[model samples]
Target: MNHRSDLETDGEPDFDNVNRSESECLVGWDDDNDPLKPSNWSNARKVKNIAPLVYCSFLTPLGSTMFAPAIEQVTKSFDSTNSLLSSFSVSVWILGYFVGPLFLAPLSEMHGRFPVYMVCNALFVVFNVATAVAPSLPALIVFRFLAGMFGGCPLVVGAGTLGDLIKPLNRGKVIALWSISVILGPIIGPIAGGYMGETVGWRWICWTLSIAAGFGAVVAFIFQEETYPLILLQRKAARLRKETGDSSLRAAAKPERNAAQIFARSIIRPLRLLFLSPIVSLLSLYQGVMYGYLYLLFTTFPTVFRNRYGFSAGSIGLVYIGLGVGSGISVPIVGFVMDHTAKSVIRKGRELNPEHRLIPLLPVCFCMPIGLFWYGWAAEAKTHWVVPILGTVFVGMGINTLIMCAMTYLIDAHPLYEASAAAAGAATRSLIGAVLPLAGTSMYEALGLGWGNSLLGFLALIMCPLPWFFYKYGGRIRTNPQFQLKL
Candidate 1:
């Protein structure tokens, strides 16, 4: 049996023998500048790896809404006029998002990011093709849900990869850039889907999206590399043990967990955080509600534009452009301000905490409801099309800012468990978005566009103060033992 050398460095064990015990050697980055560490990779390498993931991110949500313009066409083909069912055609995919992250996030923890991402992307492509060729509406919905299940892999895994690649201080901007893919995908989907559905057929929307996803899968398979350090080190340690005949060589500090336990923990831990952790619960609720409101707009926009503004299906799609512009403009500004504020907090002799992320959200809280109120009243009164469009711009900025801040805060709070943290947030938001749109048409029909949206705006106003509460109390909440993952 080989033993460690007596190299007294910081009172830690130092292994000198080739066949030393696992406890005698630490398996991590060789040093601060180690090329193996994702954070230390060149900027070009980082972009090369991250850009595909970002594009995948955009494609997933784009798939979710690409069918928005085709909903009526689909309903007519299926001979179904039930509003709930019509909405479900769009929302069942999101329901799949709720289920996918529960398993995918944990699987990535056990395996690695690249394998899960590639497999999921391929699954997404296959299901999207099935959706395009489905013989019935039920078959189409099932295919769509399957597509979304696979599509959700990027949302969960991408954040973890970003956490691995970027330092905490500089994560905001990269996250912001990644978020652009997400924000733009849904907004742009309708623009294209509307034109296609009106011109060729609704089925072409699925065909086009599947083609795009196939391209994404190919690019990702060719370019993206494994990111999770633990997996890489584990593989390295296995090779070293095989070569050196050392049975004790291990990558992790703790005893190995069985597959069952790891799977259980992955599913349970996020749920615990969602329910028990105040920070997670508040952030999840806020982000989820905002997501639901966005989906609500997906339903309401068509109604308001068609009935009030007398726009064609293709012309109605143009209204989403304001939201696209607003979100694009806000990404850089919010990212810059978030990074600057976090650094300033550190400069002032304060330990950097997730709370600093909320600084950018201070102005955003008021923007959501104000925009909603403006949009509601303007649409109710049948004002100029530009008025409601501008209101959506504010709503877009507000929600985008809130999402960026909440996500960054979650990532910062749980650096080791970023994937799980993101899974919780994604699942919550998806659940809300999936269910909320079902009521959108009825609400608008009963309350009219003005009062219906005003109700949502009021809810936004009520929720606006949540960030302030969390920013003040997050440190204390994080200190709870239950909230901390073993990782």
Candidate 2:
């Protein structure tokens, strides 16, 4: 079929959603054209449906980094001087990000995405409240870890929700918008948390997050509808069986496995994709590197400015604006370019290869290294604070581009393993992000900012060709039997 027909039909309907001889009188959608199918939802309805997911996605990551400025105060509140323990309290939330998705992504597949969002969002609010009232660092760390797990659910399940709502071809813009939400949360977090930490106290940081999350939870519970197709079909089947008194009626698309099996695959398959698939492993590595560095820079950002620039806690948070501005500018640009690249190939009668998605990476990949060099050297030079801040813009643009380009490519490349591949990518990225900052202080101290950043810049420059290498030969790599994952 041509692209237009592909867009129009979205392939043959699942037998459960449209009764056919093959389905043997199984229950299904009202008809082949049922409007309840997420793909068939109206544009306005789609936006309304996704609003909560987008909002929660934005809010959860904010919880992770918004407390960056308050770490010292949070530590002092417990009367401890251990630097490792303090950073651990903050980074453990990211470790929750790693653990949450490994299980949550699969559970969403079993139960459906809507319920997970609701349960996770509400738990997130409750845990943050726990964090606020905790009497000691150990208590605080435990609460924050729980918060991180629930808070990070949207990052795993929300992508699948977006896929449910938007067709593959039109996903570029929505993904870009989603990326901005994910990226902006951390950027905006410190700015808000800084002021609260400086003036009110560190506890308000958690209180504010809980308050914002409570509002988000209520709105999402009201507005977000279930988008997973299998669950929708299952619901319809149950309704049909009840009405018609037909015990045999069941959704044809329903999974054969029990819940235990479903959970096992959720745990194991992501690992398989991460270790067994070259495309997954490599892209995940690149994405993980970007994510790790982001954590490294942001967590250490306060000490950098406080010692060098004599900036207040509140002012250090504002410095995040450079990265935020760069991300803001790149979101639309990356989205447009990604969709255009594939469509342009289609116009020329060429099929859309998954590699088409990586086209943007070739150019934008350089932004990371360049930005690192600029930010590092400028800070070390102490020419002007603004000079270092400007460097973060490139860093922001590069990271945004990776989220859109690399992440989108992963989805396109592994259609069957989308959730698993995504989970793996997210898992490694979060794990690295959580662990790498432990070394950031030492690396900066030993190397100094100029040499430290230049070292990173050179490393980035060396890896810059990764995009082109993949773009050139990604198809063969995808099809290679050795790299193919059975799970």
Candidate 3:
């Protein structure tokens, strides 16, 4: 587990350096002047590095829900009277999220993070602009789908980049900052979209998002540097060859598989893990259910506030502030608990294993069921609005904890293939995002808010013990022959 920056030494270039290449050289051979390494960077510069990742996280989730408030406007403009079709305008982007990560995650592994990030984000920007100007509903849906496909890159790649810069011991805090965007962006977007759609028109929602994304792109170009270890190593290997006049310098850590082989394996690995590895299967199922529930809540919030509470569209958006607030409160707490628990477990003489990291999730697992029950029963009873909002707070806390623990565990389990492991998780969750919202309206209408949400909570209660089960048995499960082959 050598740090990526530790691979380089400042001696006369080993002309005969058969073990280095330009890309590999760039990563490990840190010069005093290497501005790319976050450790070698100034405080201001490190903040600048982190800023784009935060922005990227914000943009992706913002894009996911920005159109929710505008669904009515889009349906009216398109002259389509179907409610399902209208819902499609918002949910279809999530469909793109499902598709993009499968390929983009692998591409980042092959090409380096910066190139994939820039290209995919640029594609997102272009389609977002198109979405703003779409003349017809079909065109709008098409553009949104494409924009989402591109936007998915940031969600997967951002974690990989963070992994590159921060060691495991220091990652929790940095990851908490990164997680803020994911937690808050969905909650905030609808608030803005509600106001923007009501006042300026739904098209302006796209325009506003595009403008923000464009600014993010510019910031990323200026501040973000390549952080993938393999790509950096290749760069270093090339530099050494030039300096020492050695044509044979090669990266010590080249991928054993060639391009074609890597591509094939990348495409196949996620599927294999899903079916063959209980650890991946269980985690993916948990993450998917959580994400599905989140989207279901997002789709129903407008209806609950507008019809039941007589809130205007803009005011309905403001209610999302509760969700955002709850998530914000959870970030620091989860980060602290996660890091503290990890350290404490090691101190207690247990093996210094990542399974210990899963301990903090126990509270979140219990809280999820309680929150859902409170929300469902309270809303059904027509209690004060604050009761349901309190339930939402519990939900937010549970979601954040689940996500942080699941991802960290995956990264720990498969450090060699973190990008792919993350992609597998993202793929399952995004599919849930795409499908759950389409059914949300129907469920809420039939079951009413109280029972509909209670059902979700009960399911969570049943699943609450899942992480603990895995924590106790996961290391043995991971050692199975089938799991080893997938890894």
Better of 1 and 3 by lDDT: 1
Per-residue CA lDDT of model 3 for 1-487, tens digit only, reads 3322221222112222233344443224445345644444566766776789899888888988878876777888888886666677787888898888767766877788899988987887899999999988889889989998898777867876776676556776787778767777898899998988888998889999898888888889888888775676678778878898866666545566667876677778777767677887889889889888877777677777776767676776776676677677777777788778878777898775667668778767787778778877887787777777788888877877888789888868876666567677878888887787788778777998878888888888889888989889888887777568634
- Could you report the Cα RMSD, in angstroms, for every candidate shown? 4.6, 3.8, 4.5
Stretches of candidate 3 above 4 Å error?
1-45, 167-169, 229-246, 249-256, 480-483
lDDT of 3: 0.76
Give a tens-digit lDDT track for model 2, residues 1-487. Answer: 1111011123334542344353345555565557877877999999997878788889988888888888888777899987767777778899899989877887887889989988998899999999999989989989989999999888888877887888867875787678668877988898998898999998998998999999999998888989887788778878877998876777755576788977787798888888888888888888888888878788888888888999887888988888888888887787688778878999999989888888777898899899999999888988789999999999988887887788778878887666667778889988988887777777898999989878877877887888898999889999888776677
Poorest stretch of ten by lDDT in candidate 1: 5-14
Task: Choose 1 or 2, whichever is better by TM-score.
Answer: 2
Best by TM-score: 2
lDDT of 2: 0.82
Q: What is the C-alpha lDDT profile of model 1 across 115-184, one tens digit per residue?
A: 9998998999999999988888889889989999999888878877987788767886787788778788
Question: What's the lDDT for all of these models?
Answer: 0.81, 0.82, 0.76
Residue 140, candidate 2: alpha-carbon lDDT = 90
Q: If the candidates were sorted by their TM-score against the true structure, best first, what order would they fall in?
A: 2, 1, 3
